[model samples]
Target: MNRSDATLFSGGHKGAEAEFGKLAEKFGINEVNFTFEGHDIERKVGLKILSPDELKKGDVSMDIVSARMGRNFSKVDTIRKVIQSIFHMVNSGYQVFVVGWILPDNTVKGGTGWGVELARLFNRPVFVYEQDRKAWFSWIDNTWVEVTPIISHKTFAGTGTRNLSEDAKNALEALFERSFSES
Candidate 1:
């Protein structure tokens, strides 16, 4: 597959999202970072600033979000917009890649977890790189199964915690290497 033909969907925040954007650039892959007004992003490449109407298309009640992830999120405009934009990322990407820790409750940690939960809800192919375990896990049959995942879809998502780890960074490099090599 021509790497340039592939597009990465991400938030373009620091840590995993920014790293993913960098890797996407290194691999000659296109990237689109979704955001709304007043949102601060570390990487500015391919930013698609969603209009209020556009952002509203992905909006959902925080109560529903909390119920799905088994945790309560702060009720705030910024966080709401973040969640709404994440819905767009997952909706646009057929496959999703994330870097973060998966809690025992099966939900991923933090706001990144919302993306994972959205992926699951949308039935998108989602992979999570656990920094603590130094391993990758894929969502399969309602469970997170350890596996070696690659960038299979031409359009996929890369998201995770802002607090990235060295191993996670290396893991992403390996992922790009493994993907383009096999391609």
Candidate 2:
């Protein structure tokens, strides 16, 4: 598979997002990190700070979001920008990959979960490296199925939890290697 033209759209925050940006740099793939002012993110290589107007394009009712995810957001106002930024990332990428825990309730944990939901709503291919399970799972037929995912799409999104585990870090590295390593 050719990775020369691969582009990763990410939030570029700490943990998995930062790791993804680093790996994209290592493999010479283009990366775009969507962020807004006052948002603290670790990766700055491809920062695209969205203006207030741009952010408004991605906005939706927090009540609707909570209804879709089957849960309420603690601080609706503060997390609004993050949801908007994620909208840009997922909207740009045809595929979504993440590193986080999958709860028994079937929803992925934290803010990253919103991305997964958006990807599903968009009908884009979504994969998550379940931290506790230590395996990759793809959203298929409304279920999480174990699979070994590679970067097949020219454009993809990488994101996940801030509390990344060592195993999850290695999994992300392996994913890049498997996708970009020369035959």
Candidate 3:
């Protein structure tokens, strides 16, 4: 069997979770391993099912880590933990996909979103697919950024010129073609 691991990074608190679920279906991933805090009663009971160390290791073989969101980003240690987790997953040979969802209109406060920022800082390729283009662009600023699932002509600076919706399919096709031709 041919299999490659992929990690999907998203905010744990909001729409990103739903987006992650959809992406999982698109990517054919059934269950994804993630860290869940046990602050709540239900979560605590669930956490009891496995040891903390085992949880850190992962629930199953080849199941790379997935982060939904972070509570705080001010501390360097918190950011480092996330980076370290991601680095470990990638080192395990999983392709990282950073997904960012739009924040609510009133809560557009800066600083809350860091999953994509951490991914970029670590020089990982980001696969950005969002519901609202304008809002997402406002969050990630497209001036000099390159993201996957390229859905907009304004964001498609690659070889082909096509509608944004076709960008993801086109890009994947190009990659397969290049790889096959090279071999």
Candidate 4:
């Protein structure tokens, strides 16, 4: 049986967790690993940004991580940690997917935004589930192009759509295969 591993990137906010949970439920939990900063509580699988000593030094919970990520753009340390975690995941051959809200100002939340940017910079396959549009979009030529057929918000809210065209799925599978073979 052919299988693929994925890394999910989210904004790490209140609603974000629910979105991620819905996504995980939709796409079999075993198929993807969620990454938010250095925490992966469910799968217990992720890149380590802080050593045991660092974690032991102070309060380093998901709440703190979430707060730090909220200010990631201005916090060099937080930004660096987030970038490094993303780099590690990409380098380890995990397909990246994003799910979050796009703000009124046309900007995504910090960590999610950074993950999308990193995927673009590294030429990795990145898909974003637009909650409002109820469509899956991909970054192409510096813009978001819808990649899947339009679906209802209920469908989007339910088993998160993974029904890309056969050609698109094949292309993504090939990318994952190549990464695995290379590794």
Please report the candidate that would top lDDT against the real structure.
Answer: 1
- lDDT tens digits by residue: candidate 4, 1-183: 112233333222233333444343444322223234445343332223445334333323444444534543444555445444444444443345555544444344555555555566568665666665655577777677777422111111111222233443333333234433333
lDDT of each: 0.94, 0.92, 0.31, 0.42
Q: Higher TM-score: candidate 2 or 3?
A: 2
Where is model 4 more than 4 Å wrong at Cα? 4-72, 76-79, 103-107, 149-183
Residue pairs clashing, model 3: 11-68, 12-68, 12-69, 151-164
Which regions of candidate 2 fall more than 4 Å away from where they truly are? none
Output the worst ten-in-a-row residue range by lDDT, candidate 2: 69-78
Q: Which ten-residue region of model 3 has the weakest summed lDDT?
A: 153-162
Residues 21-70 of candidate 3: C-alpha lDDT, one tens digit per residue:
34434544332323334311111111122234544553221212222332
Clashes of each: 0, 0, 4, 0
**Candidate 2 per-residue C-alpha lDDT over 18-93 given as tens digits, one digit per residue, 9 for 90 to 100:** 9999999999999999999999999999899999999998998888778877788865666998998999999999
Q: Best TM-score goes to which candidate?
A: 1
Model 1 weakest 10-residue run by lDDT: 174-183
lDDT for 147 (candidate 4): 78
TM-score for candidate 3, residues paired by index: 0.37
Q: How accurate is candidate 4 locally (lDDT)?
A: 0.42
Query: By TM-score, how accurate is candidate 2?
Result: 0.96
